[model samples]
Target: MAMPVYNFGAGNPDPGSFPSQALAEATARVLEGAGETLVTYPDPKGHPPLREIAAERFKKNNGIDLPVDSIALTTGSMQAISLVCQAFLHPGDSIVTEEFSYSGSINCFRKFGVRMIGIPVDDEGMNVDALEEALKDLARRGEPLPKFIYTIATNQNPTGTMMPVSRREKLLSLAQSYGIPIVDDDCYADLLFGEPAPTSFYALDPDSVIYIGSFSKIMGPGMRLGFFAAKEETLAQVLYWKIDGGTNNFAAYVTAEYLKDHLWDHVREINGIVKGKLDTVVQQLDAQPDAFLGHSNPKGGLFIWVKLPEDVDPVRVLELATERNIRYGTGKAFDSQGRDVKYLRLAFGYASHRDFEEGLPLLADCVREARAITLEARV
Candidate 1:
């Protein structure tokens, strides 16, 4: 059977909505001035000016108050996570993360043979009680404590749950008490739709938390640009893992120029558009509350995690939806434990309202069909 071509699967920004004109102009200007620098082996620590600019932006917008000496540019935030994980974690060390986490980060930890402990989450974000219990259990057994608590603090991926201000403080305090570091993934923090987002975890525990940011969600994914802010000592350790020979100088230059010009403003514009798309999807989901249960009402982010009834098979629905020209990320791809079969990660940022409205009915129908099939198999 021919599959439908709807692509709610991708988490990337809409191509038509990217600031191509501004980026093109900035890239051209940088290239003209870059001369031999673009061709030569770049600085191993990344372009200095770019790092400085990123540090300034973080301080201004996120209240991070970081110095250029505390920042390191990497190919992407994914690379930054990998480097940090490699630098700090030993083979048997365990890392604590949310029950639902960014799959890529989980995979990276797996590569290093590091154990991962999935802490439960609630409306306030990661459940502090659950984490405390886990910590206590590990301590009692004389097991090695987690090296760090990695979290998507703002506009968390998949679930789109942002940790509230009080929760942030509590989480930081817990980490401090345990003497473990916290890796705050703030990549989606800028996409906030509410009045004002809470300050990052790094701002709260500047000395212990490593802040990771990226231009992929704000600018474009292909830009391959990200930066991290940490304590000078931790950042120095991260630099020791820089096997990229040097940083991607051209990307850094382009990002620096773009920020100096209008990148932040452009982000606000994209946020506004994405907000509307999210609202439309939410409204659609609301209209059929029985079919889609346990989903997030995201203030701002690229994805909506929908929990369908247990009888609905996401893989079968994905297959059927694809046949009707609609697609979404099946729960299997995001589930670290291979047990979340009733969930689906739907991205609305890439599709227009008209497309969503047109395709949603087909998606609903696909779900119904999957539910029916499951019932039949049970019978």
Candidate 2:
């Protein structure tokens, strides 16, 4: 039997769903005028027009009050994160992040040989009590205080929990008292599914928080365009570290042109489609109450974290699901210790509900099979 190839593992959106027509039109306009400039090494900082458009969008969407000079265009949000890590961290410097965080960010810190301390999180996001304790513990040990606290404040990945406004304020206060900066990753903020999107942490603490945003989720990841906003001082410091020859000029040009021409309307339309598919997945999982122990109703973003019963080993289930043509990310991938794993991060933005609806039942069956196998092995 041929195994199915449903990839719920990656956070990528369906390529066909991207606004190809709109982007194509935008690219044509740029290419017509981008003559010798396209062949030359572009601005090291970024294309000025794109930075201006990004500044406007940031103010409109995130309520960040920043001039265009405060924004730096990067190849992707990943590159922005790397720049921050490199600029702020030294051999003995440390960072505080959520207990379960974006694996890519963790890998970046590892590359710098910086110490990472994972703060525990609850439904509201990173646990405030745990953060305070961690800070105090570091202080008592005579260890260097964390240079910055990195967070996915809104629509957090994996857990899909939005950090409450009060918690954001509290975190800012704690970091301020400790003289620590906050790196706010708002890549998924614009995808809010409901009314009253929370104000960004950058809006709350513009002076202390450096904000990173990406069009990958909005336009297409393949575009590899993202921006980081900070106070001029920090922006200048970070810009010095951008040794990518000339700042990603082509990406900036395409993104700037797209935004200036108001092509985000098409992007918003794609988001609507994603939201519907996300709702369908939630509804389907809701119907199978016995199989799904706990899950998040993501307000925005592409992923939902599902907790399964104790007997179900999500890693084994993921392997079994591969045999059946379905794929998922196991809890261990997001955890530090990678033990007692029973959670799965499911991405619903890329596939049709029909795909998930058909594959989910088989996924549930895989869980059952994994549990049975564990019991058999133990006996």
Candidate 3:
């Protein structure tokens, strides 16, 4: 029999942890209370109660005192981001993001025909100094400044690093000086294992920041609920592009009803499960340190970025692993420039415990073998 494929590529939440029963109950409650409203379309901005609940949660969690009207629900955070891009970007315009980021955003930026400048990132997330230097260089070269700085500062995707509030302050200061906007993507903010998230950029200066939040991480992505929040003036621009009539009204009602009562409790439960899965991947990687060079120690989020030996080509490692029925995301996908080939993002949340226990060792072995093969070729 063939060994089962272990997929560690997609940033999918654990299927086992999805609260099906709770959602079903919530769905029933919504129907009983407002079943008649289904005949009419929902508010274009979204269900008012859902927006109110999201605003309250943002205030409670991110320390942002946002009005409910400023919040616009979307199909997912991707759509929220798409709306922002549509509002601000024109062809030949410029934008900035971390050197390594979510591939989905990278693709979105490319689709707009805008120039994307990637700044170096460290453990604390985007290096603000590097960002400032890049901005200064653009000015020196007589180039236009980027329209906005887009950052996944909280539990950043792929790398799974969080930016400290100090860094956030510095970044905001730079944006202010340059007269640029900041798109703060906080989709993974609630997935932290235990550490408290830093103050968000929107909280630091709501006037200059566009905030994005989502239920895809703590809840299931299939629910398809996420939101965008900004000052009324800024939000008004993006709302023009959110022309999908309205996001799914039924999903909004059910999600809001469920999360209003059980949001934090559900967050804690999901974090516990994903954190344990992360521990498994770390433990396996730690056991064979010689096979790898370095890996990120993420406090929270769904991924661990592992860097391979210099000689070990990730393409080759992936090729070998694929033949063995294993799957993972390549670092190049997350890189806007497609130059990073030594890194792999292991998404532990989507895989089962048994998949990690069995597949991780096999993955380590593949790396060692790839490294040996690379060395032999170098000889």
Candidate 4:
């Protein structure tokens, strides 16, 4: 008999928490109320009510007063990112980002032929000092300023570290001094647990920061809804690049209707689920403190980053994990230079409680075996 497969790789949402009944009810209401609109194209900026809802949510959550015109709905945050890349970047242009970042965004930047200058990240998130030093170095070499500073400040992907407000202000100051704009990705902001989230970059300086958020993390990714708030000038450019006739109207309408009534409650429910999973992951990792050197203690996020012993080979771990029907993300997958092999990200969002209880130990065993192999090689 084979061991059951447990995939801990992708940051997928827990299906058990999905608001299926609520969404179905919302969908019926939307169709009954505005079925006629389906005959024509959706508003290019997205369903109008959805935009208003997005802006309202933004203001309520981040304390930023954004006009609806300054927000554009996209298929998902990924599309929003692509639109920004399309509008702002030319081949050989540069972007400043964390040393390890959301791989999807990294891939998107690569597609645009943009150079990414990576800065180190600590517990509080991107190290502003390193960013400034990089800025100084570029200026010293007479290089053009990067197109923008991209950051996933709150509940950052893979690592699960959130930036403190002080760090955000300093980073904003650096961008201002360098005459560079900031692309602030806050898709995971709403999912934070335990502590209150820090101030948003958009709220601190709307003019200099292009803020992006998504329903994927809060509601569910399949809903495929995301939006960005920026200055009118920035929004205009991003809109021009959004060639898709519009984001899905059906999803937008249903999501807007559901969120208007149940957004916070839904967010609380999902956060509880993810937090429990994260706790389980932490506990499992704690059991093997020797094999897993250390892990990030994210306040609220879908992943926990684990550091393996120095001699443990990540490739060998992956190979062993594959045979055992376990999967995870390597640190190199998120690295700007694709050179790191000392870390791995275990996603706690999708796996069931039983899966985490059973699978994580197996993953730790794989690491132990890999470490043994490396030690034998050394001998």
The lDDT per prediction is 0.80, 0.80, 0.87, 0.88
- Point out where model 2 deviates above 4 Å: 336-340
For residues 45-117, what per-residue lDDT tens digits would candidate 1 score against the true structure?
Answer: 6888878777766776666567777788888889899999889988988999887778788778888888788
Task: Give stretches of model 1 more than 4 Å off.
Answer: 1-4
List TM-score per model, in order: 0.94, 0.94, 0.96, 0.97
Tens digits of per-residue lDDT for model 2 on 279-303? Answer: 8888878776666777987878888
Q: Model 4 over residues 1-379: C-alpha lDDT tens digits? A: 8779888998788989888898899888888948588877988788878888777767776776778888888988999999999899999999998998888998899889988898988888899989989999999999999999999998888788999999999999999998899999988877877776888999999899999989887777888999998988888988998887888988888889998888778878998999998888888899989878999999887878789898888899999999999988888888876776699988888999899899988888999999999999999
TM-score between candidate 3 and the true structure: 0.96
Candidate 4: count of backbone clashes, pairs at least 3 residues apart or interchain: 0
Could you list the CA RMSD of all candidates, in the order they appear?
Answer: 2.1, 2.0, 1.4, 1.3
Question: How many clashing residue pairs appear in each of the predictions shown?
Answer: 5, 2, 0, 0
What's the C-alpha lDDT at position 273 in model 3?
92
> TM-score: which candidate is best?
4
